[model samples]
Target: MTATQSGPRISTEDFRFAFRSHPAGVAIVTADAGDGPVAMTVSSVASVSIDPPTLMFSASAGSSSTPTIRSAETLVVHLLAADHVELAKLGARRGAERFGDDVHWGRLPTGEPFYPDANWLRGRVIRRLDVEGATIIVVEAVEARPRDDGMSVDPTPLAYHNRHWHVLTDRSMLPPAVAPFYAVYGRE
Candidate 1:
């Protein structure tokens, strides 16, 4: 039999450091409590199934938006574009300042808050898994709206890696039709 070896168990810091090397798309998850709107930035939003049009994302329990999200029947997920770096940073901040007057947002017909200019998906909670100080929420999409400008996907999606924001650029790797959406956005 071949020898089997085990490496030393990694600490939490090491786990985080390893995760930092991978890049993830940034999204703003928003829900409306009876009072107003609550939001948080997450990089974990991912598609779970296409047949049913479902998606999932995890949120820390410490986030003020968590309770609201758990209580709400539906939530809006905004896939941010490269130009929306400020919005992501704003949502990452704690407190009422996130939905302040400075941010441009609106409520959907169903009352979920959304960014009119950004691509969004509205989903109804189908399953919620509670895991150590966090919740893993799974939702089945009920509505989806692409950017008003008719872009299928933002060519330059705002990504988070190594604890910093980044814009991925590799035209050769993109499909011909998807190439046009990566237009230079402001400072990018």
Candidate 2:
């Protein structure tokens, strides 16, 4: 939602309402410029201009990844797999020790670190739009799979709403289940 929304300075409730209104695909923005690695959960990530193969994501000023994200001119936006919720949470966390030998990490030709389990994308930061409330970062995709896991799009996407993480799976498409709340938020 646009900040101005055809009007003036909105109220705090308006912002909260806007944020809760939509279902957003959760993503973790990753960065590592020699001082270890860092990442954060951001729903603000989106494709800006396809002509130049560009995209962008915003990070809060108070984000622990602020310096790392701002310092590097590039980053790796890894779309999490179904089983990677823990990884997503780990990345979003602040001041946690990152990079375990158990988790996969690799380098691109340009020396960019990436995770293999990522739903496939390696991007480079292009420019930053210094807005009043947030930093609008623009990026260009350098490496990504045209078809991840041989699928045009993921069968399920990791989603977040109402302060909870959800697995939007194909099973959700099934007709009414025994659960009550399940009747409300239809699946798929």
Mark the regions of model 2 whose C-alpha exceeds 4 Å error after superposition: 1-8, 145-155, 171-188
lDDT per residue for candidate 2 within 110-166, as digits (tens), equals 666666666656777879887766788888988784573554354467877766777
| Every model's TM-score | 0.82, 0.76
In model 1, the worst 10-residue window by lDDT is 179-188
RMSD of each: 7.5, 6.1
Q: How many backbone clashes does candidate 1 have?
A: 0
lDDT of 2 at 170: 67
Candidate 2 backbone clash number: 1
Residues 34-129 of candidate 1: C-alpha lDDT, one tens digit per residue: 867889999999999998999999989999889998888899998888888888998898865876677799899999988776778999999999
Task: Please give the lDDT score at residue 43 for candidate 2.
Answer: 73
